[model samples]
Target: MNYDEALSYINDKSKFGSKLGLASIGKLLEKLGNPQDGLKIIHLAGTNGKGSTSAYLSNCIMEAGYSVGSFTSPFLERFNERISLNGRDIPDEDLAKFTVKIRTAANEMIEDGLEHPTTFEIVTALAFLYYNQEDPDYVVLEVGLGGRFDSTNIIRESLCSIITTIDYDHINELGDTLEKIAYQKAGIIKKDGLVISYPQKEEVVKVLKDVSKDMGAELIFSTEDIEVVEKTDYGSKFNYEFNGIQLNNIKTSMIGEYQIYNATLAVTALLVLKEKGLIQIKNEDIYNGIFNTKWKGRLEILKRDPIFLIDGAHNLQGIEKLSGVLKLFKYKKLILGLSILKDKDVDSMLDYLMPLADIVISTEVSIARKLSAEKLADKIKKYDKEIFVEKNIKEAVLKSIELADKDDMIVFGGSLYLIGEVRTIVNLL
Candidate 1:
């Protein structure tokens, strides 16, 4: 099969629709010899910061002169962005070959009366197979959904499990309360293993502490031990202390003050690996890794003249973080372009976003799951009367630009899908 055929085959499996269990994936991987069995994995799960933490950790490990593989969801630009080896996406030819092999294994499962794997499960299986063949030294795996039954949870254990800030998201599947959501995320913790986490709400902290005690895992809260020495719009410099060893002047290219916490989580995880002799990463390598790390679609400044920025703040907690960062910038007027999926808490997200905009242009991504522009406008009108409805994403972006002066700022986001489309258009312009 070719690249287009491979994508079609994988896309066809989406009809299975995000089955939240391990049975199908387990059966499929078992048929392929359980490639995830003996590899060193760093499993990450949370409502926000998983992607950024994965990027920070993987880049650091690769800088230490080790081969690293990362598996993340909802690619920003291309389908191949979901899996990478040492920062490079899997070659299209390799993806095609792996799809052919996985397709046969999936067929066997169906013929044996087992359920068909979902699209995420198949892509995860392919990642495991490819990593097994390539034999990377470390694999940084991000949970596609809640951690407890997520397909990536098929791995029995990980060298380290990292959980970023837990908040209310995916409530329909995970649960409603913060404790319940924390339980699902805490599921990635293994018996007698190590866990690194950001400072969380009081309820979330209690849940994580209880789970760590029950699992015999050692939990290290990164936020309590790290300090942000200095920060700017470009990056941050921080100091982290662990096991009586303190490192200062650590920097990261990823913007936003919240990223300091994410970087610290990555550093804390690396220190755990160091203590266990799992890898030999030095302070210099950590410095370089943090300095060079880049994860797109989070407060990314695409242009300077009109100050175009795109962020993937699709949920309430994420929107709050984005709002905090936006307050640090100066602009003549804030022109907003927004879109979101149907399942998100749109009302809560708009509550955080609508007040900050001088003018809001409601738009929709070209996806079945998107909220219609008119409906989004209805939500925005309740908060801000200065709202415009533009059904097309590109047109909405252009409209924002047309309304903004060189001193003004145009911030377009609410969904990663929207950010990806807007980024593509901005780059072309």
Candidate 2:
């Protein structure tokens, strides 16, 4: 099998299961010798920031002279991005081989009258199988959806679990309230294990605190003693002090305020790993790890002349954060491009975004769930702003640039799918 065939096989399967639970995933892993049991895990879950947090943690551990495997969701560029090692995607040959192995095992299970694993389940199972063979020192597992029943949550144990900023998302499957969503994300906390959380709403934190107590797990919020010394368009500089670990002037190349919070959570988790004697390293490793951490699609600058950029703010909470970052920059005008899914809170997202944009270009991503460009433009028309519709993302990219001057900033956002295509068009991917 080749990479294309492997991806086709996975995409051919159902996106989700007929029922929601871990039975099928557990059975599939058992059939494959439960490779998930052979690695140490740092499980992560939240509405946003999972990708950034996972990137920070994995880079740090790898820089500390240890191998790390990472499994994140919703690839921004390629399918291989979902499973990576030491900040690199899994190789094409290995992905094809493992997908074949998983298919054979899944077919056997069907022959035995068991339900076939869903797309996420099969890919997640492939990650475990590959990681077990490579035998990385650690594995960073980012939850694909709500954590409680997410396919990645099938692991039996973890060294630590992180819950990044939680908000209203996937309400139908998780819940509508913050507390209810917090309960779902807190499900990744293991019994008598350690869990780290970014600062959250009062109610959300309460739910997390209670869940940790009930599970006999210890919880530490990463806000213990974080002080941001510098916040600029260039990057961030901060001082972190937690549990006798003093990190001064820790720097990250990532922009925006939220990335600072993610960097803190990642550093806290790494300190725990160090305190437990998991790896040998010094402050230099942590410093280099953070400074060199690479994450795309969130306030990433694609061109300096026009300052063209892209972000993955598909939900209301994410839009709010992106708006916060945009507030800091001084530009002649904001030429914005957006393409979002049909199920999102479109009106609320536009409410936060429309006012900042001088000209809005609505585009449709080449996905089944995308909100059509014409319909999206109609929604923007109510805002009484300059709106343009382009069903082709490549055209939208060219038009956004055409609408921009060297002094004006062009930002493409509203969906990860849009961001991925923009990156590919701009040749950054």
Candidate 3:
């Protein structure tokens, strides 16, 4: 099948919807010769910063002269962005080939009385296959959702397990409270594995400590060592002082103060990787990679003239970061296209962003779970009577640009789905 045909066939399995188990994935992988077993992996899971962490770590490893494979979700542009070798995303031909293989295996499973894999499962299998075929030195794997039962958990162990800040997201599946969510993310920690984490709530920290003790994992906390003194659009200036090492003047290309923690977490994980003899990387690689890395749809300034800021801050923790950055920018005519999954805290998102918006353009994303534009508009009207509803995201983009002035800023967010669609519409991808 061609790339588009393969993608269509694979996505159709989403109709069965999130089954939330590894049994099906395990069986399927076994049939495909267990591509996950032959490689070293740096498994990462969290409520946020997983993508940025993975990207930085992969780049660092690559700079050290190792072939690195990275897997991230909800691609900003083409479906191929979900898998990459070194810095380049998987080529269309490779994705097409892997999809065909996965489809063949899936059909065989169905014929043998097994259930078909879900969209995430198929895509994950393809990542493993692609990485294995490329013979990478390491694979930087980020969990698509909650870590415990996630298909990526199939790896028996990793060189190190990293968890960025945990918060309430996917409440229906991963629980609501911070402590509950922490436990789910902590699932990636294996017996005696090295654990690296960002600053988290006290209760969440306690839960992680308890889990690490139970699993005999060695835990490294960012707050215990790393410190940040400055932040700006250029990069963050920080100091890294470990028991045996002290490094200064570390700067990352990513914007926002929150990335300071994410950068530190990546450094901590790299230190652990070095100790394990996995890859001997230098401090220069860390500095260069972090300073150069950029995760799109997070406080991204798409157009400077009209000032279009697009972010994928869907959950409360993410939105909180967005709110912080928005406060730093000058006031302008804010045109927003916000839509989140059904389980998200829609009310909290509106409560946080409504006050900043001059003209709110609510719209649904490509996904079915997206809250309808009309419904969101109606809800926002209760908070502010002048909410605009545009069902089509592309049309919403045109409207936002048309109504916005040169000095004005158009902020698009509330979901990664919306940010991705906007990227496609604006030809930024």
Candidate 4:
């Protein structure tokens, strides 16, 4: 098996569709000798900020001079990015090697009258196999979906579970209300474990508190004990205090107010580990990690003049955050490019973004779930902004550049898939 073959084997499983249970993943892992067992895992789940939060934790731990392995979803650029060791993607040869091993196990499952593992399950099993072989000091596991039954939830234990800011998303599987979503996010909490989360709505807090109590897990909300000393377009200077760990005059290059919550959540989790004597970490490690950790495609500025920015703000809550940032920039005009999955709340997202743009171009990604460019343009046409349809993503991006003056800003967002494509094109240009 080779790289292309590995991708084909995994992508072929997508036809089986997604499932929200652990039975298949559990059985599949059992055949693979349960590589997730005894691994020090920091499980993360929520609607937004999980990736950014994972970045903080991974970088902080690695900064403390330890090898860290991270498993995240929705690859921004390459399939290899789904799993990484100390910020480097898994080698292509290793991915192909694991795919061969997993394929055998999957076929055996089918022979025993069990369903084939979904694409996420296969990839997750691959991650476990890859990490277990390398034996990193820690594994930062980002849930592929809702936590309770997400493919990554196969582990029976974790060092800690971190829940980033939660909002309405994956409603078809998770649920419609914030409480329902919180319950799913809370599922990553193991019995008698430690859980850290950002401050949330009252109802969400109640749900998390209830779940923690029921499981005998200790839950701590990263208290809103933070003050923004100063903020620039690229980063912020803030003072944070919680659980007697005070970080004053800390700087982070990640933009937006929500990232402060993510960093704080990560810091709170780190402090808890330090108190329990789980790992050796210091204030300097925390400071360096927070200052240097980077997650691409989230508020990334591609160009200086004309301000070409791309963000992975796919859902309503995410778009709301992006809109908040857009209001602060001084520019001649806001040229926006959008492409998102059909399953998202299109109307709500457009409602938040349409008003901010002087011109809107609706384009489509290569995925089957994407909303067509023409249809997306049709929806934008109802709004007051001048809209265009460019089915070709490259053409769509080029048009945005052509329309923008030296002082005008161009923003390409709404989907990670879209952002990845645009990032490649912009880099080459």
Q: Rate the local accuracy (lDDT) of all candidates.
A: 0.89, 0.89, 0.83, 0.91
Query: Per-residue lDDT of 289-361 in model 2, one digit per residue for the tens?
Result: 9899878888888787788889999999999999999976779999999998998999999999999999999
Compared with the true structure, model 2 gives a TM-score of: 0.97
Shift of residue 56 alpha carbon in model 2, Å: 0.8
Better of 3 and 4 by TM-score: 4
Question: Which candidate order results from sorting by lDDT in descending order?
Answer: 4, 1, 2, 3
Q: Looking at model 1, which ten-residue stretch has the lowest summed lDDT?
A: 13-22
What's the alpha carbon RMSD for model 2?
1.5
Q: For every model shown, what is its TM-score relative to the native structure?
A: 0.97, 0.97, 0.95, 0.98
| Shift in Å, residue 384, candidate 1 | 3.4
Candidate 2 error regions (>4 Å)? 13-18
lDDT of 3 by residue, 268-374 (tens): 88877787777799988888887888888877877776778888898888988988777666645776667777768889887888877778888887666878887
Pairs of residues at least 3 apart in sequence or in different chains that clash in candidate 3? none
> 248 in model 1: Cα distance from truth in Å?
1.8
- What is the C-alpha lDDT profile of model 4 across 169-240, one tens digit per residue? 989899999999999999999999998888888998999999999999999888889998876678878999
Measured by lDDT, the strongest candidate is: 4
Clashes per candidate, residues 3 or more apart or on different chains:
0, 0, 0, 0
Taking all chains together, the TM-score of candidate 3 against the true structure is 0.95
lDDT of 3: 0.83
Q: Which numbered prediction scores highest in TM-score against the true structure?
A: 4
Better of 1 and 3 by TM-score: 1
Better of 2 and 4 by TM-score: 4
